[model samples]
Target: MIEFSEVSIAYQGTPVLREVSLHIGEGELALAVGRTGSGKSTLLGAVNGLVPHFTGGRLVGRVTVAGRDTRTHRPRELAATVGVVGQDPVAGFVTDSVEEELAYGMEQLGVTAAAMRKRVEETMDLLGIAELRDRPLRALSGGQQQRVAIGAVLAAGPRVLVLDEPTSALDPGAAEEVLAAVTRLVHDLGITVLIAEHRLERVLQYADRVLTVHDGRVSAAEPAQAMRSAPIAPPVVALGRLAGWDPLPLSVRDARRRAPELRAELPGAPVPAPIEPGAETLTCRDVVVRYGGTVAVREVSLSVAAGETVALMGRNGSGKSSLLWALQGSGPRHSGAVTIRGTDPAGRKPVPRRMLAALVPQSPADLLYLQTVGEELATDRAGEILDELAPGIDPDSHPRDLSEGQRLALALAVQLAAEPAVLLLDEPTRGLDYPGKHRLTALVRAFPGAVLIATHDVEFAAETCDRAVVLADGEVVADGPTADVVTSSPLFAPQVAKILGGGWLTVGQVAGALR
Candidate 1:
């Protein structure tokens, strides 16, 4: 259904992908993997003619989708044949309400009104977003927006589906549902799906074939062979490699079957050393954030002392973001008292408030307005901090040209430049790799100020956070140590925790403790 023949893509004379020739059969689900800025997105964008066409790049060869050449047919011309859902769902939204967004694609294709309405309802039901039909697009959580984005394309009945980090923003359960829906489309409906994702642990098991984009070349192989030498890998695969297993395990269930013999080497459930937080503090009491009739955040009260890293854990729309924004003093706060070091940020100017408490929202792009990486990190110590957070990024590269992880690192560096008293990060791990995440943990761990991270990446929470807080329906449900909170919930538990089963939250913890 999709074919790339001698394809070489370059931007401004700099090659991104070189001589890539591959064919994906009808109904096959092919997963594309690579390091940040290694041409994974560029390759995926080429599937529907977004690379050289809309992106203003040079293409040397042909990209055919459903027998139509992408070199001649642009993204708009191939929209009905190839549906592309990018990393940022909100950026692609053209309609206000969820129902309209679902039907807008079909309307453009001139589908009959009766068929459009039926497809819209079917898609809403398929993705479990029926209740959000009338809700405005802007009000939906990042995960909700992602689902709507997929539904919008699915409603159009496209033959080929291209998803760029489809579940980056989704909660675990929601991710499973969405993936299940996609797999069903591939199996039951015979629709081809191509997914480019950094979070391989979520989709590897579901993929039939794996395509690794490395050093300007695309290597296609089975999941096992592809992961053998892949630069980035999930914790389970890392653990399998660490243990010298014959065939690497991709899923938790598979890892657990082989974990018993390995568990004997490590004799203890890790007891993390308690951190000594500083005296400076950030406290939010009775924080309530409401959007029209929706009470996004209830009367939630939380506190973070200086030198502390707290993970705000919850499902999508669980008020994790609402609480972060409220504490930042920019997002809506109907009634709340947020103070950092005895100073209320609500009364301060935007610039002054940033100095008090800086927030990197879910969409880190919102914090980035600069043209290049160098300009974004022009402030004192900003470039140094970025090197610490994520190294090897080119300062001359445009912010748009950077991968999701690279852009996120840039956005983080921009916020850290202010030297705020309290740092607020919402979904900070959306596009970070395992090594990059390690660097991020080191950076957050060494930061002198208090930090609150609103995230769904439990593995990251295990590594970086000193404490964890869970929110449900905009109210605090549980607050405790990272190991305790993450291990107690199966959905939130990391792969290592599921495999080793003795509070083993990470491969580092297990490897360090082993005989």
Candidate 2:
């Protein structure tokens, strides 16, 4: 369905994808896994002629998708043969209503009204998004928006679908729904699917073949079953290898088949009960927040106790970010009150004490403006903070010049400069590499402050935090120990849930049996 022959692309005279060659067969599901800026998105763009045509890149070699040569085909011409869903769903939305959003693509294709209506209904049912047909596009959650976007494309009946991080912003439940819909589209409808994703654990099982890309080159392309023991395996895949299972299973049910044998090989230990409550550090009492005329957060009550780490989870626009900012006293919260260690941290008082509640914003760039990473840390504190958080990062290197992961570490080091007792981090691992994410997780776990992380990375929350809370529709729907809460809540359960019989979240715990 798609073929790349010695293909290379450069943006603004700078090379991105170099001599990439691969073939995606018809009605096959292929996953492109790679770290950020490794040219994964560039490869996807090449499918629909977006790389050279829209991104102003120099394209070399031959590229074809759905029997059309990409070198000659423009994005508009390829739209009928190929449907591309980008990383951000909101970026692709062109209408206010869900029905209109789905029909927009068909209208552009000049399909008759009867055919468009029939296709819209069929696609909506296939994606199980019929209930969202009447909702305003702006008011819908990110996951809902993503589903609608996929439905819109499916309605067009394209031969091939290219999705870039479709579930990156979705919750575990929503991601599953999207994946299930894609599976149906591939198996039932016989559509060719190519997906680029960072969350490999969720999609690896569904993928017919796995293509691992590193530094703009294909490192490995093999059957998913044969690639189970690769060093860079997901937690459960590694666990399956360690558990001595032959023909390692990709999904949880497959792993469960070996559960009895796994149990026999282990020395059973008592699973600890959920921890008791501690002294309140940052407490929110019936908080209400509004934007313009619409309420963003209702009477939501939650607390981050002293010396504890809590994870806030929900769909996008589900008030996770709003609640995090509200704790800092800068958000739209008005009715409810929040107190930090017996006093409102939001109140104007001593600078030193107020700085105790440090907030790490969603974007690291917001906190990074220093000419040199070293100078940034040095300018903030005399020497002690720099010595602790930034042990080896050059104190004089420019922050903007560093890699995404490096910049994240540098930003985090600066956030820790205040030595805040209550640290608030929002999606700290969004663009980080595996190693960078591991380092950040360790940093968060080692910190002594009361930490509240607002994130969608369930695995990270399970590994770093002791407690987890689910915030949906601006209210705390569930709260308890991280493992227990995640395992119990359907909304929060991730691929890791299938492996951790008692709901374990970390890769380390999965490795314990191997040791």
Candidate 3:
């Protein structure tokens, strides 16, 4: 009941989506998958008329949703027919309390006060956020705020739901909750859902059909089966097909149907044998960090032995990033101490010396500021890009002009210039596509140093890390083998485990067993 006909949109005089025509049937769940900057967000905006109307784009063709012409309707009017939950929910927040946040949307539609209250309560219950009704929007965690945003839109009872990377900012556990809730709304309540996500494996099973968008055009639209066989299938999908499973598994349960053989052949899985222990390298002892009124991290201690790779896992706002910052001497630490090679991080003379630590932030470009990529590398150390450990990225071009993968490579090359003994990566795979992630992971594995990574990509952690640390509410909750924590623990278990079965933590492991 939602359609786009010969649609073309340009932002700030630049074309983002061109001649894209598609339709979403009533109650059908469809997934729009593409690489970064592929116009997936632009496609979702057209359904709600946020395109040429609100976003200041030049619209070429007609768009309609739920029998309403998008060109003729404003975002407020379209909200009654379509619900939207964006990637950063906090950016859309206007109210303080959860209850008011839900009511605000309906209130804008001029819904009767009594009906608004009833709808708000119903939505909170449906999304399992009833207990958070009184919590202030600022006080809620990233996941809680996102759920509240969904509930706010659902309260309006739209016929169609359009979400743009709704789970991109959420942790694994919170992401699962949001996805499950979306599926329930579609299967049991008959709501049409269209979602654009980079994590294809997580939402592949829920899709009635999969559409691939590339370079601002609809590249492929087919049944899930056809999409699975396409040359550009997600890593897990390709691995499932290679394993000879009949009709290849989409979700974990389907993969588990063959778990008997899968488990029996565990010996054949090509997991790297445990390496010999190395000497102590980077260590954090009783670290405590507070942010004004709240203690974000407290007395959290961890260590990364020489040649060891450790992963930090947790829900968003669980103090994972805070702990990383404290270790890197970027965030404020209230009490306790951190020792890297017997050198405290809080000291003023900790730069590129006895305890050198390089932190690769969530956005690699955040640390990049040179005119040319070669100059960016030169800024840190001459000929640094030629290091055998660095990825092959063009050196002559501007850093901002490179692709996400290339930019990530350049960031690493610069960080390695100092030849730091310790590396700290925070969300290294945030915006990467399937291939980009694999390439970056390879680079991480090849680096010669102790590494500590904090990420939501649990599969990556399982593939790269030997030890895992799970943090929640400013405290270390669990720490042990990466496989044990990711596959068995409640906090670190990823969607891959929930979808593909327990033992297959990484795509390589899953593919190896299948072969």
Candidate 4:
């Protein structure tokens, strides 16, 4: 029930979307796919009249949602017909508790108190957030916050829903839960859903239609037809293309049915050589971090050797983020000892923090404070550094104006310019497409130091890391080579491993074996 007719949008004489024409029928789940800074968000904003109205841009042509023209109606006026959930859930929160946040949208729409209460509970049960009714919004984990955000929008009872990178910060299981709930909404309630996501593997299975945005142009087609030539696709689709499978499979179950012949073609494929870690660069002993009565991290001891890349993977709220912060020496540690190059990071030494380690948190905007990319680069003398890390970013664009992937690249460039001995990144591929993720993999491989990354991206870990350290309930449960850890665990295995039933972790490896 969303329509865009001859829509061309520009900001300060720069074109973002050009003459885009498309229609999304009611009850259809449409997926938007593209690279970073490719106008996905801009198109989503135009649905609720936020592009030219709140964002201060120039809009030409028309955008209508549920037969209401967005050009004539403001976002508030169209609130009853459309609901939007952005990338950052914390930024959109206006209340303190989960129950309150869910009810806030209904109250804003001037619904009766009884109706608001009923919808809040129904939405909570629908999204499986009933246990977190009284929890504070700020204290919840990223995945829990995401559930609350979606529940809030669904409680509004709108005809259409627009979500931007809805599951970027969630673990595999949690992502499945969120997508299942959205699918139920489209099928059970006939509510149209439009999602812009980079992790196509997780959401493509549930989408009825696909929309591809590339080089400022938008095209729509059936999911199978669109994925055949789409610029970005999941690993299973890539594998199907490489093996010449007809009617490419979108899920692991379908791929496995057709994988036997391909598996027999390449009998004994060789695994890539693993990286050998050098001398110890970082060490921690009995690290414990607590928040009031809750122990986020228990007595955990870990070490990272020089020239090693270790991926710290676990479910949501599994203490991965807490452990990373504790090791950084900037966050709270109730009782622990962390040493960097044989020196305590929290000691009275004169060395700067940047020299020891640099952390890129989940929210990259927290580390960016400058107005524009040009000024931030000038402050750190990182013009050449950013170019080497992630090129083709506009210097005059505001840091907030950049897309999620571009913002992440800028934050990484700013941190890598310091040349730290150790690097820590949390959910680095949150909004990055395949190309952006490839560039990040290359950059991480080229870094000359020990690196520890806390992430839920299984594909990325398989492609870049040499080792995997998995934590559960604030304790280390599994730690070994990447292949051994990922292949042995069902929850953390990549698509290729699930389909081929071997140790194949990526499509590139299968292609190598066939060649």
lDDT of each: 0.88, 0.75, 0.76, 0.89
Q: Model 4: per-residue lDDT, tens digit, 1-515?
A: 99999999999998889999999999999999998889999999999999889998899999999899999999999988999999888899999999999999888889999999899889988888999999999888777888899888889899999999999998888888888888988999999999999999899988989989988889999887898999999999999999888898988988999999898898675566767788899899999989899998989898999888999999889899988888877778999799989877664332477678888999898889999998777645467666755678889888988888888888888888788889999999988899888888888888888999999999999999999999998999999989999999888999998999768899888888788
lDDT score, residue 266, model 3? 57
Please report the candidate that would top TM-score against the real structure: 4
Comparing 1 and 3 on lDDT, the stronger one: 1
- RMSD of candidate 3 to the truth, in angstroms, is 4.3
Mind giving the per-residue lDDT tens digits that candidate 3 earns over 1-515? Answer: 98888888886566778897888899999888776556777788888988767767699888989889988998877888999987668878998899999999888889998998889888988889999989989988877888888888899989999988777667877888988899989998899999988777667877887777776777545545655545345545654665666677776667667656656655643555576647788888788888888989979987788778888888888888888878887678888777777776665464644236888776688889989877877754534543333344457767775554456667877776777778888877665666666666666666677889988877667777888898888899889888778878654665445545545566666555655
Taking all chains together, the TM-score of candidate 4 against the true structure is: 0.97
Q: Lowest summed-lDDT stretch of 10 residues in model 4?
A: 345-354
Assess the local accuracy of residue 49 in candidate 1 as a C-alpha lDDT between 0 and 100: 89
Off by over 4 Å in 1: 114-118, 121-144
* Model 4 stretches astray by more than 4 angstroms: 347-351, 379-381
**What ranking of all candidate models by lDDT puts the best one first?**
4, 1, 3, 2
Q: What is the C-alpha RMSD of each candidate to the true structure, in Å?
A: 1.9, 4.4, 4.3, 1.6
Clash pairs, candidate 3, are: 252-499, 252-500
Model 1: per-residue lDDT, tens digit, 1-515?
99999999988898889999999999999999887768888998899988888898899989899899998898989999999998878989999999999999999999999999899988888778999999999988767788889899989999999999988888887788778888988998899999998888899999889999888999898898888899888888999999998699988888889998998887867879778999858998999999899898989998899999999989988989889888888888999788888988886899899999999887777777888889889886889888887787889988877888888888888889899999999898887777788888988988899999998888889889989999999999999888889989999998898888888888888878864
In candidate 1 the C-alpha lDDT for residue 263 amounts to 86
Model 2 alpha-carbon miss at residue 227, Å? 2.8
Query: What is the Cα-based lDDT of residue 349 in candidate 2?
Result: 55
